[model samples]
Target chain A: MNQNKNALLLLTGISLFMAACGTSKTGLITIQEQGSFAVGGKVIASPGTFDPYKPTPAGQTFHGDHAYVFYQIPPKARKYPLVMWHGIGQFSKTWETTPDGREGYQNIFLRRGFGVYVLDQPRRGNAGRSTAAGTINPTPDEQQWFGTFRVGIWPNYFEGVQFARDTATLNQYFRSMVPNVGPIDIGVTTDAAAALFQKIGPGVLVTHSHSGGMGWLTAIKNQNVKGIVAYEPGSGFLFPEGEVPAPIEMAGGQMAAVGVPMSQFMQLTKIPIIIYYGDFIPEKPSDNPGTDGWRARMVMARLWRDAVNRHGGDVTVVHLPEVGLKGNTHFPFSDLNNLQVADLMSKFLKDKKLD
Target chain B: MNQNKNALLLLTGISLFMAACGTSKTGLITIQEQGSFAVGGKVIASPGTFDPYKPTPAGQTFHGDHAYVFYQIPPKARKYPLVMWHGIGQFSKTWETTPDGREGYQNIFLRRGFGVYVLDQPRRGNAGRSTAAGTINPTPDEQQWFGTFRVGIWPNYFEGVQFARDTATLNQYFRSMVPNVGPIDIGVTTDAAAALFQKIGPGVLVTHSHSGGMGWLTAIKNQNVKGIVAYEPGSGFLFPEGEVPAPIEMAGGQMAAVGVPMSQFMQLTKIPIIIYYGDFIPEKPSDNPGTDGWRARMVMARLWRDAVNRHGGDVTVVHLPEVGLKGNTHFPFSDLNNLQVADLMSKFLKDKKLD
Candidate 1:
C-alpha cells in the first residue's frame, strides 16, 4: 500500500483498539464526615485521586469511587480480565506484594498475559471520607479500628439501601467495560467480581468476608452469576444460633435486625459454590477457631448442592484445606497467603476463559 | 501506718501500675521519603534528633524508626517482645491485617499474652526513595509495571556492610532495654535476622535465607547466641569448592575472597539447632518454591545435626511432609492455608520461654 494509505489504515487500527478497549470513567467521589473534625485528621486515598466533599444530604450521601491500577501484558490473544480487590483499610496494592518482596499477583498475571485490575472500595484505597469543610483524608485510626473490629466503617459506606444501589451501579460499570477490554466470563466473586459477572451476562463469582453477603445478594438477585467461591463469607448461619447475633442494617431510617439465612440463600441460587475458611483461627469472636463456623457454612453448601441436583444442574462443592481462601475475621483479601487463593481461583476459571 | 503514709503508699502503687502498663521511648529514629524514587532504590540514612531529615554522611543513611503497636492480654503473659522484620517493601501494618480482615498471627500472640514489635525497614513504608533533581517521569505503563515491583524497605535499608553494623547497634539497644521491658533476646534469621543476632549477645539465633550466612559468621566468629532455628537457610557448601565469595565490607574495602567456611563455622558453636523446609516445588526459578531448596537446606542441616550430635549437643531436622504440613512453599511465614513454619517457630520458642 502507499504511505498515505498505510497511515490511514494505522489510524483506523488505533481507533478500533481504543473503541474495543471499553469505557472506564475515572473520577473521585467523597463522603462527608459527621461530627466535629480537625485538620491532618482525614483518610487520604492511596494513589491519590478521588475526593468526596461534606454536607452530604441526609439520605443521598455516601458517594465515592475506587481506581484500579491497570496493566496490559503481551500475547494479544483472547483472555479474561482479572479483577482483584483489597481488604478493609488496605488498597489494591496488598495483592501485588509478596512477603519476600517479589512482584505481586498483578505482575504475575500481567506477565502471563492476563489483564489485571486492582479494585479499591468506595471508602477504601484512594477514595477517602470527606473531612469538615470538604477535604479528603483517611478516616481516623479510631474509625479504622472500629471498622476492623466489625462495628463497621464510621458512617458506613455501602450499607443498607445504599449498598444495594452501589452494588448495582458498580456492576453496570463492570459490564459496560467488558466489551472494551475482553470478557467477564473469567470469574467474579467479591463485590466487584459478582457485579462484573452479573453485569457481563454469565461467569464465576468469588466472595470473601462482608462481600460474601454481596455474593448471596447477587446470586439471589442476578441470574448471570453461574458459580461462587465463598471464602469465609460472613453469614448468620456460621455463628451459633444465640451466640453471635445477626448484623444490623438500617432501612427507612430505622435499624433492621436480620439474620443471614444461609440455607435459604443457597437454595435461592442454582450454581456451583465452594465455601473456604482458614484453619488457624485467631482468638476472636468472629474467627472462633476449630471450624466452629464450618458446620453452618457446610449446611448452606449442602442445601445449595441438593437443590441444584434436584433440578439436574451441575454444581460442585468442595472444602479447601490447602487454601486460606478466607482471611481471618477481618478482610479475607488481605491475607498475604492469597497467592494460593489466586492459584486456586485461576484453576477454577481456566476452562471458562473468553475467546 | 499513719494516714499520710497510707495515702502515699496507694499513690505509689498506682504509679507503678501506670508505669508498667506502657512504656515510651526517646531518641526514636524517624524515616521519610526524600521524594518519589524507585521502590528498591538504594536507601540513605543519617542521624538528626530522630527527625525525618538532616543529611550527615553518604554511608550513614538508614530508614526512620518505627513504633510497635502492641496489645497485652492475660494467661500466657505478654512480657516477651518478639522483634519482627518484614520482608522487602512491606510495613508492619500489612501483618496487622489478616486475610479476612481480622488480626493475624502477630495479634494472635497479643491475644495469647505476648508483646510483639514489627519494625519497618528504611526506604519503605512511609519512607520511600526520593528521586534526584530533574529525573524524568516514567511512562504511565512503566509506572504500573516497575512501580508495582518495588523492593521491601527492609532490604533496601540494611544491605551490604551497613546491615551488620545496624544489627549490632539494634542488639545493644535491645539488651540495654531488656531489663526494663522484661527479656530482650533477639530472634532473627535470613540476612537481616542473622545480621541482627550477630551484633548482640545472642540467646537463640533463628536465621532464614541469606541470614544463614550471617549465622555461620556469628557461630565461627561470634559466640553470643544460645540456640538456632534455621528455616530454609541457604548453604555455603552449595557453592563450588574454592570459589566461595568473600565477606563484603564497608569503607570501600575488599578482603579475602573465600566466603565463610560452613564446615569451619559449624565447629565453633555447640548451640542446639532446628531446621525446617516446605514441600511444594517451585514451578519457576524466581517463584521461590523452596521445595527444591529443602534438600539443599537438609544437606546443611544434617551436617550441623551430625556435628552437634558428635559434640554431645542437640539438633533436629523436620521436613514438612513428615509433619503433614502440606501446600507450603519457600515463603512459609506468609503461607495462607499453612503457617507450618511459624507454627513450628512458636513451638520451639515456647520451649525456650520455659527455659
Candidate 2:
C-alpha cells in the first residue's frame, strides 16, 4: 500500500508539471474572490456603435460598434494615419468626455499628428454598469469555464471576452475602410511590414493601457518591432502570488477580484517594459485588503524589476505623481492632463530617437 | 498680345494649382502644412535582414539588406510607439544610448509599461562608425547596395535627407510590424505572451517625439493602427511653415539636427495626435538661443511655452512652471532633473486604465 501511494504521488507531480507548461495556451487563470466590496450594479448588455468624431458606415466592420469615446483631430499630414483601440469599459467614451472641460487624449494625439481610434470595450461601460450586477460576469458555462479563465479582472464573461476579440477584429477590419490606413489582418500587417523592411526596413509600433499586453505580445512576436513606449500598461496581472487583491477597481471603493493569467504577459514577454502608475500614494489605510491598485502597481514594479534582472535590457517603472492619477481609472488624457502626458511622451519619443 | 498675356497668366495659375496638388501625394498637403518645420539628416545605410535583431537564420526571406532605425515600441499595449530616426551621423542606438549614459526618448515608454524597440536603423548604424581611410563612407544608397553600416553616433556628422527612401522603407516595415505586437498578432513572442486576443482581437497604438512622424507614416502605410499618441514629433519637412524650436532646456546645448520628419507624422497619417512640450523660462544669457538646453529650467519654462504654442498639440498644451525641468536636452524622455515625465506618462496610462 505504501509503495503504491509513493508511485501515485510521483505520477501526480509529473502530471502537474506537464500541465503547467502546456497551459501557456490559455495563460494562467486569475480568480476573483468576493469580499466586502460592492459596486453600482451588474453589467448591462447593449449593442451600440460609438465614434467620438463621427460615425462608421453601416456595412463597415466597426459600424454600430459601441465606443467609450471616439475622437479625431484635424488632419496634420498624409504620413500620419488613424490609430485607435479599446479601453476597459464597454465604452471608454465616458472618460473621453470630462465635465472638467479637458481635451480628451484623442484630440491631443490628433493635433500632434496622429489619427486617433478607440472602440467600446464590448459588454463594458453603462452596459455593464448595472445596479446589482456582480463584478464578475459569468458566461454560459460559468461553472465549468469561469474558474479556469485568466487575463482580465472579471471572470470570463463570454460576452466581455468576445467583445475584446471583436474589438480587435473590428479595428483590423476598420483600418482597411479608412483611407490611407494599412491592411487589416495581423498577418498581413506584420508580413507587409516585414516585406517593407526587406525593401526599406525597420520602424516603430505603439500601444496603450490593457492593450499593452496585446501590443507587447504582438511586438515580440514580430521581429521587426524596434522599441516600445507604453504608458501605464496593466501588467499587475503578471503576479499571482503575494497579497493578491481585487483584479479591478470599482466605483464604490476598493474591491477584491480574483487573479488571472492576463497578468502573465509581463512574465512571458521579456521585451523591455516601462510600467506607469499614475500618482496615487497609499496612506495608512492603504493596507485595507480592499484596494487593488496599490498592490497591482507594486506587483507590476516587481515584475518589471525581475524581467530586467533576468534579461539584460532596460525596463523602468515610473510613478506619475504630478498628474495625481490612480490606476486605470478615468484618464487624464482629457485636456491639460492630456497635454502633460503628451508632452512627456513627446520628449521621450524625441529623446529615444525611436526610428 | 493683351489677350495672349491674360491667357498665359491663367494657364500659369492652373499649372501651379495642379502642381500643388499633383506634386503632393496627398491632396490635403497644403492644409496640413499649417503646422510645419524641418529636421534634416543623412540616411546611413546598413545591411538589412529579416532578423535585424539577430543574424539572419537560414530561410529568412529578408536576408542581408538595407535598413535604418525604423520604429520604436512594439504594437503591444502602450500609449504609442515613438521612433527617433537618428540624424545623419547618428544611429538608433546612439539616440537611445548617449556617451554620458543611457539617454533617449525611448526610456519614456520603457519606464511606463511600454514595449520599446529600436533598430540599428538600417544604413545608419551597423555601418562602420569610422570612415574608411581616404574613402568617404558610402552614402545610405551606396551602403545599401554594398550592405554595410555601423552602430552608434559618428560624432559631428549628423546626416539628414540622404536616405529618404530608406526612411520611408523603414516606416513601411515598422508599420507592417504593428500587428506583431498588437492584439492582432496575439500569441507571438518577442516576448513570451500568448495570443490571448487571437481568440478575440487587438487594441491600440501610440507614438512619441521624433518617432511621431515615423509613427504617422507607418500608420498611413499600414492602416491597421488603432490610435496614436505622439509627443513633440518633429514638424513636416514637406510642409515647412509654422515650425517651432526644440526646447533649450530639453535640447540641452544641442538642437535636433534640422529637417527630419518627426512632426510630419501628422501630415503623413492625417491621424489624430497628442503632443507636449515644456515652457522653459530662461534665466541666463547662455540660454539666449532658448532652443538650446543651456538655460536654467526656471527660464526654460517660459521658452517651453513658446515652443508648445508653436508646435504642441492642437487639443491642449500644458505650460507648467511648477513642473518645469532643467539641465535636460531636447530629448524629452531623457529628462534627468525631473523624472516627472515618466510620472506624467504613468498617470496618463493609469488613468487610461492601461496600468
Candidate 3:
C-alpha cells in the first residue's frame, strides 16, 4: 500500500488517484484462497546417476529428477486438466507469478472456471538434476533470449526492442528465469511432463516456447492429451526436404538421444492442435526476406501444421495478431496481458471441447 | 534516474544492475539523433462558430480549429510520408510521446527512415471547440471509457480486468488522454486530417481507434492516402439493413447526429487495409457470450475488412496475440510493448514500399 501510495504521490499529472473501487471478489473463486478449492502438489521423482564431475567418496552416481507439479482444482473442473508447459530458461513458476508481481495465469484460469496444472521440467527450477553431467546439457544464458524469444532485436534493447522498460518489471522477469538445461535431456523432461499429465488424468497440453517441443512429444506419447495449444513452440520439426509425407523429425523425437523408443507426430493427429505465435514475428515481409529466428519458428509451425492437416489431422496455425494481441514477448503468460491470453486459451479449449 | 535507482535499490532478489550494455543503436536507423533531421510544425486553422453556452465579450462566435501537424524531415525521405492519426480522447500528441514516457511511434517511424506527420483533430486536444454546443458531443467522461475501451468491465477498473495495475503507468496513460468531444464535428475533423495529408503529399495512414473512421474517410476523400494501418478501430460501421453495395456508414461520417448520410463502404476497397487489435478480444467464448466493447470493435473491424475484401479490396485483420503479443490494452501504443508494435508498423510500411 505504501509503495502504491508513494508512486501515486510521485505522479505529477493525469490524476494518478483511484477511488480504490477495489476489484470485485465476486468470482466463484478468488485467487487469494488456496484451501477452499482443491489444491495438490508433489515432486515426481525418477532415478538417474550422480554427477561424474563431482566424484562421490562412495562412488554414489545414483540420483533422480525432482520435478514438481502444483495444481489448482477448480470446482466441477473440466474433464481434462490444463497442463501448462514452460519454455527454455524457465519452469512452472513462470506460470505462477510474473515479473511485475501480479497473479499468474494458473489462478486466473481457476477463477475463469478451469483446472490448471503447471510443470517444472527436470534440471530446471524446483526440479532437480540427476548429476552435473555438465557437457551433456549446455546451460543457456540471457543474451540468447534477445534474439530467440525476441525480448529485443540484436545489438541491444534500446534499438527498437520490445521488452518492458520499467526497472521493476525487468527485474521480475530476469529473476524468474532459471538456467535452462538444453534439449539434451529430452527424455527426462518429456517423461516428467508426460507422467504428470497422465497422473492427472485426461488433460490438454499448453506449451510455451522450448516446452512446446517437449509438449508435442508428450502429447504424442500420452493418449490422455485431449488437445494441444502450442504457444510459440520454438522447436523446429525437421521437414523432409522434398516430400510432404516423408520422414518427419521433431527435436523432441522419442528416440532422440534416448538410444530407443520414441513418440511419432502421426499419433498426434488424434487430437486437435492449435499453434499460436505472438505479434510481429513470423511476419511475411513483402520483400520476401529470408526466414530465421521467429520467422523460422513460424515456418516450422506452418510446416508441422500443414503436415498434420494433410494427414487428415486438425491443426490451426494462429498468428496471434490476427486474433488481436500485440507487443508480446516469448513469455506471454508472464506478460501484463496474461489473463487475456489465458482467456483466449480457455476459449480455444472450450472450442475444442477439451474442457 | 533517481526514481530508477530507488526502484532498483528496493527490488529484492533480482539483480537490477545492468552493464549499461545500452541496447544496440544499430537498427535500420537510430532514434537518438536530432541534428541530422529537420523538424518543423505548423498550426492549420479553420473557421467555426462560437459556443453559445459560454458567451465571449469579443463576440468571437466565429472560431476555428487549430489543428497542428509536426513533420520530421528526413534525408532521402520515403516516397510517401507516414501520417499518424490518433483515436478518441487523444490528439497528435499521442504520437509524440506515450504515457509511459518512452518515445512514441512518431519518433520510432521517424528514426526508421520515414517522414512522419501527426494531426490534432478538430475539437480535441490542442484543437479547441468554439461554442459550447452543450450536448453536441455529450463529452464522454472517464467511466464511459472503462467499459468502452475494455480497460475493465463497467462499474470500475478495480474489477478483474486487464488494465496495468501500477499507478505510475496508469497515471501516464490517463494523463495522455484528451477528453473526446465526441464526433459532433467529424466532417471538420476528417477534413482537417485530410487536408494535412494533401499538404504533406502522398502518405500511408496509420489510424488508431476513433481516428480509424476519420482515416478511412480521409483516405476515401483524398487520393494521397495510399494505404491504411487501422489499430483497434472501435467505431462500428453499420452495414445497410439488407443492401450489400449500399452506401456504408462510418463513425466519422457527416451529420451523424442520430442517423445516416454516411459514405459508401466500397470506396474503402480501393486501398490496402490492415486492421490490428491487441490481445484477448474478438474471442469466441464457451458461454456464447454477447458482443460489446472490444468484441464489438473486433466485429466492426472484421465487417469492414470482409466488406472491403468482398469488393475486391486488399485487407488483413491482425489479432496481436496470434502473432505473439499478449497482455496488450486498448492503447497498445501506450502499453509496455509500444516499440515492438511500432517496429511492426515500420516493417509493414517497409514491406509496402511506402518507406
Candidate 4:
C-alpha cells in the first residue's frame, strides 16, 4: 500500500462514513408544536447567586433535580400521549435521533400518530445536570457502559462480533454514550412520570431497558394510563417460574416505604402488558448477561407474565431468539432494525385497543 | 475524481476485500471423511459405443436424480444424526459455507457434537445436474432470487433503504448465490430424503424456508425422525385460521398420501416442533414479501401453529419481530446474526432432548 493509495483509502472510508448520515429535520409527519417544560424539584440554597456578600436564603432557594420533559405533538395524532422513558445513562436525546442520525423514536412515534412525550429521568443526562453537587458518579467508561446494558462481554472489539460488526459503526455507537451519576432515585422518576400523565393525561407507556420498571411505577401512580409496553425494562420478573414477582417499590408518603406486589397493584391487571427481550440473551454460558443481570431480568419477566396472565392480567412475554430474531441488543429501538421493533410494539398497543 | 485517485480507490477497495477473506480449510472443528456420494438413479438401456459407423445395441444408462450429501461425524457425537434440508434454489452448500465465508450450520452442528448430514435435494444445486433432464425447468434469476427470498424489494439498489444498508456486505451475500434451473419434484426429494435417513439412521431434521414442508414429508417418510426444527418451513399455515392444511405430497407406492389436519398430527405431538419466522414481516404494509408470497407463508404458519397447539402438538411458532428482533430477511442463517440464531436453535433441540 503506497502513500497515495492510503490517502485515497482514507478519503473513501470518509465518504462511506459520511454517506451513513442523513438529516432528521423533516419526515411525513409535521409537528404541531414542540417545546420543553420543567416540573418537580427540591429547593437547595446555592453559595452565591448575584450576591457578593449575602448568599441565597434557605426559604428562597434554587430548584434542582426537576425532570425536563421535551414533547412533540403531531398535528394529526390518533393516539393520546405516549410517554417514552429511556434506559440508564440515556435521556430524552435517546429518542430524538439515532447514532446513524435518522429520525428517532420520538419522531417515528409521532409519524405513526402517537403524541410523543420523552422524559429526562432523574440522575441521568439532562436531569442530572440540574442537580445539586456531589452525585455519586463513576468513570464514564465505554466498556462499563456496554457491559451494564448487557451489550456484550469483550476484552476488545473482537468479541460480541455480531453486536458491533464493523469498527465504523462501533465508533458512532460510542459517541451516543453518556454518563449517569448515582443510583436512580425512584421517587423522583415516579413523580416525573405522574406529573406528565397529570398534565397530558395518560394513554400508553413505552419504556426501554432501565426504564422498564418506571412504566410499572408510573402506572401505579397514574390512573389514566391505558396500557404499557416495556422493552427490556429494568423491572425484574418473578423468581421460580410461576411465583409472583417481588412487590413494586412504593415511596413513603411521609413515613416508611412499603413494597406492593404486582397483584396488589390492582390497576396493573386491568391493562395489557407486553414485555420484549432482545435476541442472543445468554441462556447458556456463551451468551453475555454482564453479571447475570439480564438473565435474571428475563426470568423475572417470564414469571411476571405467568403471574399476571394467571391473575387475569393480559400479558405477553417474548424472548426474541425464540421468535428467530437475533443480534438485538438491549436497545432494540435504536438498532438498525429500530423501526421494525417499533412497528411490532405499536401493533401490540393497537391490538390491546390502547391506541 | 481524477484518474490517479480513482485508480487508488479501486486498488484500495480490492485490498480491503482481500483482507476480509481467510482460509476456511482450518477451524475449531476438524473434518472427518468429508466427500460427496450419489444415491437413487434409474438404470436405462442406451446405444453402445466403440462402433463409429453403426450404433451398438442396448448398453446401460442411468436415469435417477443423484443425491449428493456431505457428512462429517464429530468425535463425540450425539445419539443420532442431524440432517439439513435447504429451501428451493439452495443445496448442501447452503449449510457448508455462508455467503460471508463463515462456518455454516452443518459445521456448527458438527462443532456442537452432532453428526451432520447436509442434503442437496433433487432439482437443486449439485443434485440438479445429476437429474435426468427435462424436469420442471424454471429460470433462477438473481432478481427473483433476491425478492422471492425476502432479501428486499428493489427495482434497483437505490430503493428499500434498509435492504442494502451496507453495499459491501450485500455484494458479499450475492456472491454466494448459485443457480438452480427448475421446479422441485416432490417425489424425487422425498425419495432422496428417505434414502438418506435409511442410510444415516433417523435423527433430527433441521429444515429452512422452502424445505420446511419437506421436514413434514420426511417425517412421514422415516419413522426414525426424532424431532423437527422448521426454520420457516414451506408448508403453509392454513386458511381462515381454522382450516386444515393441504395434503402432504407422497411418492408412488406409499399407501396413505392423505392430508392430515393439524388435529390429526399425532406424530407431531410426540416430537417437538419449532417454527422460526424472521423479522420485519408485514402484518401491516411496509415490509416486503415478494408479491406477498412470504406473508402468505407466514399466515399459513400462524394458522398451522394455532391448530397444532389446539391438537396437543408440541409446537412453538415464532414471528421474530413480535419479540423485538427486527430487520431479519428470510435467511437469518446468513445474516450477521447467524451464529446467535444457531445457538438458539441448538438450545431448542437440547431442550427437547433431541440432541
DockQ numbers for every candidate? 0.01, 0.01, 0.01, 0.01
Model 3 / residue A158 / CA error / Å: 8.6
Over the full model, what C-alpha lDDT does candidate 3 score relative to the true structure?
Answer: 0.55
Best-fitting candidate, scored by DockQ: 2
- Worst ten-residue run, lDDT, model 1 chain B? B26-35
Candidate 3 lDDT over B81-109, as tens digits, reads 77787887665556755544455676566
Instruction: Kindly give the stretch of ten consecutive residues in candidate 4 chain A with the minimal lDDT sum.
Output: A249-258
Candidate 3 chain B lowest-lDDT run of ten: B30-39
Residue B36 CA error for candidate 1 (Å)?
24
Instruction: Please provide the root mean square deviation of candidate 3 (C-alpha atoms, Å).
Output: 30.4
Per-residue CA lDDT of candidate 4, range B315-343, in tens?
A: 88877667655666777665556777787
lDDT of 2 by residue, A1-355 (tens): 9999999999988765433222122221111110001111111222344221222221111111111122232322223232333322212332232223333444344445543433322222211111121212111121111111111222222221212233332222111110101112333222322332232223333444544444444444454445455554544233334434444442224423224243443333444444454433343334322233444544555554564445455565556563443322213243234556557655554555541
What is the model-wide C-alpha lDDT for candidate 2? Answer: 0.32
For model 2, residues B1-355, the per-residue Cα lDDT tens digits are: 9999999999999766554332122221111101100011111223333221122222122111122122222212354433333322223332342223332444444433354433322212221111111111111121111111211011111122111224333221111110000111101110111111121123233433334445444444443343444444442212223443453334324333223345443433333334444433234444223222323332332333343334542223333334554323333444333256556655654554444
lDDT of 1 by residue, B231-315 (tens): 5554442222354444322212222222334465444346666667655433232212112334434555565566556546566
Candidate 4 lDDT by residue in tens digits, A1-355: 6999999999988654433221122312333444444545444433322221121231223344556565656554676678888876565556765555455687677767677877766544434423323322112244444554555544343233235456444443553433343246777777877777887876788888867776777787887778888888665332233343444322111111124654445567788888888865566332232434566667667766776676677888887667656667777777667777787887887788777
- Each model's lDDT comes to 0.36, 0.32, 0.55, 0.58
Give candidate 3 regions above 4 Å deviation: A1-61, A135-144, A154-163, A180-183, A236-263, A282-291, B1-355
For model 4, the superposed segments whose C-alpha errors exceed 4 Å read A1-28, A44-59, A129-133, A136-140, A148-150, A155-168, A181-183, A236-264, A285-291, B1-355
Q: Of models 1 and 4, which has the larger lDDT?
A: 4
Error of 1 at B127 (Å): 6.4
